[model samples]
Target chain A: MRPEIVMLALAVGACTWAFRALPFRFDLTGLTPEGWLSRLLAATGPAAIAALCAVSVLPLVKGAAPPAPLGAGLGAVIGLWVWRRSVVLATLGGALAYGAVFAL
Target chain B: MGEARAQFAQGMVAGLPVVLGYFPIAFSFGVAASRAGFSAAETTAFSLIVYSGAAQFLAVALVAAGTPLLVAGFTLVAMGVRHLAYGPALMKHAGQGRTRRAWIWAFGLTDEVFGVALGDLARGRRFSEAFMAGLGLAAYLAWVSGSWAGALAGGGALAAYPAVEAGLGFMLPALFLALLLSILSRRQMPVILIAAGVTLGVTLAVSATAGILAGMLAGALTGALRRATA
Candidate 1:
């Protein structure tokens, strides 16, 4: 209901669209692995992702809450262990573990 | 036109795997958005508009945290900066390809779509805008529909199940961690580890916003400088 959500969505959308659509229209021959641009891309995805994961999870871990840690940690461990890197399984497993732990 | 249709069909078929892969993630995004207080319409609009899984997840989390709109917007865009290269990379791999309708189909160029298209090209498939369209559409529909389904299934519907809802609260972090693990490589390990450490430290010492920005900067700088030394 907040107007900010709409504006934020549209703003992000436009910027993302430009990211996806522009390279098709331009020549970026110099953007190679050896170049800083390549390393920047290479570094950015995982690093940002890792940072995001840590930032998001830190609060839960720091809270010392059993359900969250159990659900998130065990779920991720099991999900990764069982699904061989399936996001669905990990998320599902984590939620299940949390629920089961909370219930007990 | 028939050839285009055939190519499109081929693309649709190629996109089948992506459709399967996107559903769960999109569904998670939907559930997270719903739980984060987004209406089904707003959540669906996110997939319909922004379309990137990581960016959408970040957007939902940021919005939930009441992060300043500017910070959230910049973070979302920054997370997607890598995508700018996907297009160029795909084009490069697609030597002697079509570009006439790229403005349209390019919009569907999500990471998975790009991977499938690039793999096809690498395997000697000719580049075709029609194929890209087919691929993008199949994946896009799956994402939007998956989000809708998850949104409908989550939120108010789960009110009675506090335990389950608590578990689901961890879904965003769980998904992000899984994604992080999937992409973990020997080359990027240092960058990732340092980023995680820095993000935690700064966030604990200062603010989440400063922590994230600092983490990104530290991680990126580490990644860039390593190449110079090695």
Candidate 2:
């Protein structure tokens, strides 16, 4: 390995370590209003949730090639189906869908 | 001591997915760096120095566009601010240690660490310092190794690895979606929707990374609005 590359890796490692070391000044009050809003957003009704899903799906039927679009659509469907309560699944599904479409 | 060991083990297991995910994305970062007139050494340095995915991508794009380094730096710092959002959640756990230690851990904190730590906290679990260290180390390796892979591949090779590359990129969104869903309650859906909508709109209108900041701002504001009405 080049000395320069080794040094670069060390630098990135140091920075990564540095960022993780920052302190958390706890002002519990920061949670007051913002916390409540996050709760509200998290609990949106099924209609709104469905709308979000629909919005995600729109990327499919609009203007794109079949492979990726199809993959995305299918992934979204699977994501929505597998983890109806999971935003992670949905997002993952979309990303995988896109990847699969492009790759396959 | 037992708690610390368990947390560390858990961190290792949980990080498996991230390691798998980061490889391709980091590789792409390397390739992009090479394409942007970066020497292999410079490409490696970027992953090491900047160490941010989107920020590095955008930085190179900006540089290519003839944007000033200052502009790139400003954009990077602005994007880095998102780390602040993850603060309170992480500090809740790391704060149990000495103030200095807490500060040190906070510096290494990234979305991945915050997500894992946050999830553990939500489950009413407290991580030993070992666990936090384990988590941070796992992500760091993935990022660095992945970056190295990309740099070694040179520019054109990434095109051949597009599937894996894109898949790794998907990990970030997937992980975020999962975390968001886990925490999401019926009450928080509107805030999420509005935030997502605003983020989407802003990204289309402004810079993509800037849109993320704007979206978070919009979400926070809307969250505040909803509370006032409630």
Clashes of each: 0, 37
Docking class of 2: incorrect
State the TM-score for model 1. Answer: 0.82
Q: In candidate 1, residue B160 scores what lDDT? A: 87
**Where does model 1 exceed 4 Å of error?**
A63-104, B121-124, B160-168, B226-230
- In Å, residue B213's CA in model 1 sits off its true spot by 1.5
lDDT digits (tens) for residues B23-58 of candidate 2? 666676777666666677666676656566544655
Q: Stretches of candidate 2 above 4 Å error?
A: A1-96, B1-10, B93-99, B159-229
lDDT of 1 by residue, A7-101 (tens): 88888888888878887777665566577866776788777888898987887777656744565456554556466545545555665566677
TM-score of chain B of each: 0.85, 0.68
- Candidate 1, position A15, lDDT: 84
Candidate achieving the largest lDDT:
1
